[model samples]
Target: MSNTSEAIDNDTVIKEFIDLFAQQDATTLAPYLDQDIVFENYGSPVVKGRENVVSLWAEVFSTMERVEFTTLNQAVNGDIVIAEQIHGLALPGRPFAPIKNMAVYRMRDGRIVEWRDYTNSEYARTLM
Candidate 1:
């Protein structure tokens, strides 16, 4: 089925993207994201535009005392890579974001066009 195959492709992209992100390989990530990528961080303001999306992660994430991106589960539907990832941080953690949070990756044409972060503020404050 064309739809099924498309979903599989997007799923692979998501997995590969996550792996690259875990390694903080911006060069690799660059090709996969559009020039106008959009991202939203939980408990923080949204990051619009491609440059900000990439640079924000490069700068802010590098400050984490400790962090992890563990894929707990995933599902693919057409151009959507429905995934639940475990993201945790130890340094510069947001006061309203838990050490661990859930992230969603939305892909289009083998590139990540948009992403959203979700987390619990109460749990995040405990870390702070």
Candidate 2:
């Protein structure tokens, strides 16, 4: 495959990955992740492996009434995709609010191998 095609494919995969999160379908997300995918979230221990990440998200989905992300800005460079987003969550008996955050995703072979998230932990604490 040409380099241009590979880059396009990588971007598509990353977009699909983000869509999966918006859909809150952890099961469907598994196929888009590398077997040894590493995921890091602000104020949380680094989660290793695709299966483990799926399990963790499943648990979170079970607890939250709803979770959604709106991409404010996104860019792709080589194998990396960076996004600034508004993440919103609705909890039982609590008003939903959007939190600003950023995520960097590294794609390999059309699958995300590494995902790192950045946000204001102190502000997030107040929201939770």
Instruction: Give lDDT per model, in order.
Output: 0.71, 0.85
Best by TM-score: 2
- Note the clash tally of each candidate: 3, 0
Provide the TM-score for each candidate, comma-separated.
0.80, 0.91
Best candidate, lDDT-wise?
Answer: 2
Query: Which residues of candidate 2, in runs, are more than 4 Å off?
Result: none
Which segments of candidate 1 are over 4 A away from where they belong? 92-98
Q: Give the per-residue lDDT digits (tens) of candidate 1, residues 13-107.
A: 77777776556545656777877778877778888777777777787557765555667888877877767776655575453233555666777
